[model samples]
Target: MALRLSLLLLLAILPCIVHPISAAANGRALAESVDAAFWLYEAWPRSQKPARARAPNGFAHHLRLGMGTPPLNSTFVFDTVGALPWAQCQPCVHCLPQEGAIYNPLKSTSFVNLTCPSAGGTGCPYNFSYGGDAFTSGYLATETLTVFGRSFKNITFGCGTLNQGYYDNVAGALGLGRGNLSVPNQLGVDTFGYCFAPRATFFFFGSPPQLVPNTIAATTPIVENPALPSGYFVRLVSVTVGPTSIDVPAASDLLIDSKSPFTFLEPATYALVREALVAQLKPLKEASSAACGAVGLDLCFEADNSTNATPPEVTLRFDGDANLMVSEYLVEMSSRRLLCLAMLPSSKGSFPVLGRRVLMGTPVIYDLAKNVISFQPVDCATFGATFAR
Candidate 1:
């Protein structure tokens, strides 16, 4: 369910000094207002067979929102690493089959096509390409975006005429990255947060509530590298598995991305982590070898009951005192009684990525103005209570 609530109780009287908005003049008051808040809803990731036919367990998480004048509601994959929001538009040259009706701009009275020079220059076109040969090309436009009972007018978005990718049953995606065109930026908010849970993932577009007392909150500075400016970059100092702590290379950088389902580490780092985990799980060697073959996971083991299995604790230590922990088993084999590691080697020279698996049940707060990201462990089932005044 989508709910629109104020940020007054969440951030108005918070102890920390809230950052001021640096966007356009119209957004200045919005940034200072304690009443500012955006609607948040539950998002879930699902498994689907892409063109390659390889079914990775949980691929992506999506949230549903209402758009246009009459409110054409659709499901959108929540991509924290992506920039702009785009939906399948009418007069498509080629489009994938969607679950609901593809958005028709003609049907919306508030839809306006943004043309040349005025809207980011000449035709105002945009194209986004993802890994695995998936891409979407379209033009820029403004439309009224409505979530819950609140309405945002003249919000900039992409109206895709051609879209092709492994979108599952969703209409399009909602980008929540650091780019100027991202949802949080469009809303003129310097902060946004989310709590990922197996059942229901909660997202907030304004200032998030302070960390609950006694919660394991850790804050770290976000790296400001010009080469990779969009995504959230966190410096990884080391990783700990069980009793062994593996120091990461000085040049290694870790990106926290929600789009990627599984965590990825550089080849050398992954090897070290793998070796450490293998040594820690030596008692289940025989069962792991058998389950690896059956489930196609690199590190797998047969477990009579996965819930009761005592998995080794894994911690990712950032540059500061921030340490994100992942307890319990990482992966669960649905077709069989097995559990596997949910991390893999990064593609060649790519930087390491901290994905959804390691972030489950963790409430992550992205402070844009302060250039810091805070993390805390919490009971995700009850995390939504913070949204209630």
Candidate 2:
């Protein structure tokens, strides 16, 4: 009887030894990496705030995404700093005139309206307000989202029944913030990266997306402030223009927001930055007579694509020695042929913001696990080959 039992036990364990299950695979649900590019368009708003009106032609970056079953395609603002993904929905109490057809939940087989309890008890009704009086109020729901040939089911997002804002030619906004409902967190991925260029921008989502070797020049810790938990705040140490470096207060926090078209500094900080820039540009022979303050720009100079007319370099020094260099010409108004310092003074007394114009051509990576943001300058034309690895 003992010999028989031992033989049976050995046979039972033999199959387990032959094909052991992978612990890594069982640990997490594996999803394919997302690598996609989208074209950016210019959007001009009626408001003259520096954040809204800084773009010469009014820059608005959008991407096409498929939602619901049978996939109704619609364009959305690819906002990195927003907290929730939202789109115009049917049965509208008050809906803005969108560019494409509004998504009707009844049309999609996979549509499911989540109640307050089902959506983490955060309440079913949600409202979001952004710069330039852009506000969207609606119910929270879950639906299928398809992007870059990958399908994500049961994704929690907003179905805007009431929206009020200047969305331009897009149906809604896609949130990529570091929140529970954001794309990266919803996908259960710890890493996501994005690079913006003139014609198009590349966005990647997955576990450890490939980046060019030695491309990451600097990194800084991402702080979570209790007052504003949704925003990405990085400590800015100082700013240097030529030989002048203005030291910011240690308590000051800088927000890295992509939705804002132009950077905005604190009132005191803007004054110093403007003084330094003016002193540096006074000697330039190509400087034009255009009044900087006339057109709502801080500084305006006539400059073309000529190499000799290049602007000076402005350096932003963050915590941990993360230095970001901005070209002088980059801050200029492209269509107006005026080199203007694209940053303005913040009227709300909120933290300073580093906007899209300063971030172009830089590959910015948000690592959630490490709680750090890494960035480096790269030739965006070679992004395909560089990140293919």
Model 2 residue 283 CA deviation in Å: 4.4
Candidate 1's residue-wise lDDT over 73-117, tens digit each?
777787877677788999898888886899999899999876654
Scored by TM-score, the top model is 1
**Which ranges of candidate 1 are over 4 A from the true structure?**
1-26, 29-38, 42-57, 118-122, 214-216, 225-227, 286-296, 304-309
Q: Assess the local accuracy of residue 377 in candidate 1 as a C-alpha lDDT between 0 and 100.
A: 67
List residue ranges in candidate 2 displaced over 4 A: 1-58, 117-123, 207-216, 283-294, 302-309, 328-337
lDDT of 1: 0.69
Cα-based TM-score, every candidate: 0.83, 0.79
lDDT (C-alpha, whole model) for all candidates: 0.69, 0.65
Model 2, 86: alpha-carbon shift in Å? 0.8
Report the error of model 1 at residue 69, Å. Answer: 0.4
